[model samples]
Target: MGRAGRKTVLFDEDKPHNRVTQESHGFITQDGVKPSDFKKRARTDVQKYPSVSIKEKRVEIIEKSGGVFRIQTKEGKELYGSM
Candidate 1:
């Protein structure tokens, strides 16, 4: 969506990787890559888009009324988005 000039927000809690000792396979050129390294590189690529943003907060609630979306975060922040 960011590539199409739409605003995109990604919410991540920054949890630890469960596959720390495993290598990712079947990803073509990224075969045998570490999970942490792959995530770091993917995040870097996503952040390069000006229309994309990353929020390091857990979502508490999501409600849709009328034609708008209301998002509430665990940290008491509220955001609104529309289609």
Candidate 2:
């Protein structure tokens, strides 16, 4: 979406992967890659876009009203967006 000039925010809770030590397969060019390494590379690629942002917050609730989305985080931050 960011590549299409749309503003996007990804919320991450920083949770550990259940199979962190195992290699991930099925992804082209990323087969056999570790989860942490894949995430690092993917984040780097996404961050290159100015309209994209990554938020290190866990979402508590998501409510939609009047075609708008309201996202509430566990840290008491609220964000609004529309599709």
Query: Number of backbone collisions per candidate, in order?
Result: 0, 0
> Could you tell me which 10 consecutive residues in candidate 2 have the lowest summed lDDT?
16-25
Measure candidate 1: CA RMSD.
Answer: 2.2
Model 1: residue 64 alpha-carbon error in angstroms: 2.3
Top candidate by lDDT: 2
What TM-score does structure 1 among the candidates reach? 0.77
lDDT of 1 by residue, 1-83 (tens): 88777999988877855555577787779988887888899899999999999999898999999999999999889999987
Which runs of model 1 end up more than 4 angstroms from their true locations?
16-21, 25-29
Q: For every model shown, what is its TM-score relative to the native structure?
A: 0.77, 0.87
Residue-level error in angstroms, candidate 2, position 29 = 2.8
Q: In candidate 2, what are the lDDT values of residues 3-58, reduced to their tens digit?
A: 88899998888895645578878889988899888888989999999999999999
Alpha-carbon runs more than 4 Å astray in model 2: 19-21
- How high is the CA lDDT of each candidate model? 0.87, 0.90
